[model samples]
Target chain A: MFAPVILSIKVAAIATIFAFILGVFFAHLLTSRNIPGTSIWETILILPMVLPPSIVGYLLLKVFGKRGPIGAFLLDTFGIQVVFTWIACVIAACVVALPLMYQGAKAAFQSVDETYCLAARTLGSSEWKIFWTVKFPLARPGIISGIVLTFARAIGEFGATLMLAGNIEGKTQTIPTAIYYAVATGKEDEADVLVLIMTLFSFFMIFILNTWLKKKNYKVS
Target chain B: MGMYFKIKKKLAQFQTDVEYSFDKGVLVIQGESGAGKTTVLNCISGLKTPDEGEIRIDDMVLFNEKTNIPVKNRRIGYLFQDYALFPNMTVEKNILYGIKNKPEYRDRAKRKELLDYAGYMMETFRISHLKKRYPANISGGEKQRVALARAIVTRPRLLLLDEPFSALDARTKETVYEEFFSFKASLGIPTILITHDPRESELFADDRIVMKDGKIM
Candidate 1:
């Protein structure tokens, strides 16, 4: 039980990192005027956040299963398996958590004054440098909040991990999966303890994030 | 330094047709709201591509019908009406934002010169104490000073100020104007400032261009 809990936390952390990076890129792309089909791409990115997690997990399995095109390529060339592994849990968590990070990052980036960016450009810094130095710094609060939210969401993920990675005890069984296992086997006391821990952890994260956001004057709107 | 701009473009609510040349002096653009002064400045700085135009700064052709340079290559400093300072950055970071990544000069000399200039301007404008404050923590007048400091820090070939004093109090505006002229005299760089105040134009401009309905009137 202890091992699964620790492993779940690690998986959630890694998944949050991946989602946060991709979320920043996607937010920038969505807001940039030069990118074509931005609206369509944004809608697709948000689908995972809105649609049922079970649907998302099923879709992931179809695309990344052992016989699927990408899965087959990975197996033949890289000798790597994706489905029913810890990696699958990470992938599932990232898909579910992407929209939160993207929304937060997009709002943060958009809030930066265009004139500041223009000033950087006029000073001879390239586009990449301007983003890293000026834009990213100004948008730090939003990015930080986004990371926290993504991490919390990934940690609480259940349906997607179950469908994609399965409840392999001490391997892919996360806190939520462990709770589900405990309840199914009529282990009421164990289930209660696990649920209490997960709930407290989530509440603490959210409370801290809210306080930080308020102190930094980060409005949700 | 000198710049020449000839642009013709159509927007949803307005159209622009401007042709002008600027030399090393204060060239003021005066007009009512929505008169396309900002658009003209944007075109000159390569922030907006004109459908038909040519922009030349000194010997370099910044924009022509056949060649369009990006904004980063234009090397033209701009001061927005809102004094768009990064809200999350300290004044030091805001001022150093432009020169932070240049490979040619990464030491403190340029930064020192800029800070010195900012200090002089702050003393001139009485904003010396606000150097460490963030944009959101400062007043409108302080924000304008920081914006001005940031704009002129890089010693741009052409400095464009768009409605710079519109957001300030009268006293702050006067102080900003005084600091501006002193800075202009020191740098000797060509400047094109936008204003709706006839008195401001009369006081500061060597040549005043009146823009009306997107055309130079």
Candidate 2:
């Protein structure tokens, strides 16, 4: 009963960390530098959000399944497995929720006043120094809010997590999967409780995040 | 020390083609708005590359057809019309932002020296009291002083003041002008100022140019 709840939190937490790091990295890269094919990079990052969860799961399976290159290499080299495990749950959740964090970071970076960056540049600051001291501080609130939203999205990840990680009760059976199984098995009471818990958690997290962001960034224009 | 640049660039609505040189004092460029005064400063500071020209400060080329130095390496100071102070940082941090990134200040002894110098600049600007206050919390005049402090703290070879006093009230402008002139005389750095204020023009026009349609007249 509690297994799914705990695993759900664990998976979402780990997934959010990975998503936050990668999302911010890519966001900064795309924003700061004039890399060729920027639109293509944006499209790739945004694909997971646009695609159906089932398709995303299939794609992950191709990469992480036993016969897949990554799976074969890991199995032979490290004796580790990914598919139908807790790790797979994290991977699916991260992929599906990454776009939220990425878009958030991109918006955050864009919202930073260009004058501040220009001012930093003329002040004998290296591009690296300017980003850390000027850009990052200005974008921190937005990025942290992105992390929270990503966590909520990761925790509620469903079809992809279902298809990739499968419903192993103690290993990868997160709340979404647990809810699905309970409803399918006509255990309506258990599904009801899990649904209520997720709803309450997401509402409070997002409400607090929005309120905090409003306070931190008071200028509407 | 001296600085010179010849910029030939086409903006969406205007083409700026101008050349000028200045020694160690304020060289004012007075013009109506949209006269491309700020664009010239941008080119000199390496923020905007001219379509064709050379910018040299202290006889070192900053931009040309082949030699284009990056903005960070140009060691040019600029105060934008809006002051452009980093809102997240306090007044002291904003002033110290430049020297802290300088390679020479990386060592302990030089770092301390630069810190002391920055403290002096804040005191000179009379913004020492607002050291811990953020830019958003400060008055427009204070913000300009903070920006000016940040600009000169690096000991830049050339300083560009782009309508630095435009945002201030008439009373605030008078005080800032005195501070600006004193800072300029004490530092003896070459300066290019863009201004619509006749008072600023009369006060600091050590070498003055009137720009009409991006050409110096």
Candidate 3:
């Protein structure tokens, strides 16, 4: 019981960190100015979010398979394999959860008033300084929202996790995968407990997000 | 030194073709709404590039067919119409943001020296008591002074004001105008002020250019 819970939490936390950082970076790049065919790139980036979990899992399997390009490169260069490992779980989680973070950050970044940026520029601020001081702080609430969504999505990841990281007892079986096997094998009580726990984790994150946004809004107002 | 620029930018409503020069004191560029008045200020400050032509301040070229200076490197202080105060920063931090926050002032002694000037600006602007407060907590006139302090704290050679008093009430504007004159006299930097108010132009203009549909008339 605890093993699945702990593994799920650990995977989700790690994936959220990676997703949030990369998502923000991608958002800033895509939104800052007119890039040719930016919408097309955005559609590509967001494909995973709308794609069925099974298809996403299959795609991941194709890329990270033993004879796959990335998989082969790692094997040939470093004698390492990515499929059916702890890293596979993290990779799948990051891919699925990344779009939520990206979408959230993109809207937040775009909502920043151009006037503040112009003011910062006129005040002798470097672009880097302006981003850290102005854009990031101004967009922080949305980014935090993105982090919560990413964590929730990552923790609840099932189809991809099942395909990439098989349902081993303690090493690779996460809460979602464990619950699936439990329900399939007629362990209704175990499945119920896991479902309750999963719902609680998601609710807790959303509650924290709402409370934080409310406090920030109150202060701003 | 005086500034000169001849620029042509095609706006959706009209073609903005204008040429002007100024030495010192306030040069008021007056126009009706949609006359591209604010666009002129944006061009001078390098925030918006002129489609074609040259901009030069004395011997230093800011923008031309061959060269376009980055906005930060232009050292042209712009007090935006909204005041555009960084919402996350306090009054004191906003005022000192131009200099102390940058890498060149990383030295303790150098920053200490600069802080004296920043303190003088805040004191002169009568915002010493409001230093700990954020922009949202401050009055309209107080926000004006803080924004003014932030713009001039870096000691730029040029200053641009985009209807800086527009957001203020009549009562606040009257008091701010009094402070602005003294501040301008003490600094003696070249300033270009954009406004639609004739009364404001009458009070502030050392020289004036009236614009009609993006053309200087």
lDDT value for model 1: 0.83
Tens-digit lDDT track of model 1 for A1-105: 686789789999999999999999999877765788888889998899988999999998988999888888899999999998999999999999999999999
Runs of candidate 1 with Cα error greater than 4 angstroms are A218-221, B101-103, B107-128
Write one digit per residue (lDDT tens) for candidate 3, span A81-145. 88888778888999999999999999989888888888999988888989999889988888888
DockQ top scorer? 3
- Candidate achieving higher TM-score, 2 or 3: 3
Query: Sorted on TM-score, highest at the top, how do the candidates line up?
Result: 3, 2, 1
- Over B124-161, each residue of candidate 3 has an lDDT whose tens digit, in order, gives 88999999998889989899889888898888879899
- lDDT over C-alpha atoms for residue B32 of model 2: 89
For all predictions in the order shown, the interface RMSD in Å is 4.0, 2.7, 2.6
Cα misplacement distance, residue B208 of candidate 3 (Å): 0.8
Candidate 2 lDDT by residue in tens digits, A25-132:
999999988999999999999999999999999999988888888988888899989999999999999999999999999999999989988999998787888888
How would you class the docking of model 3? Answer: medium
Can you give the DockQ of every candidate in the order shown?
Answer: 0.51, 0.61, 0.61
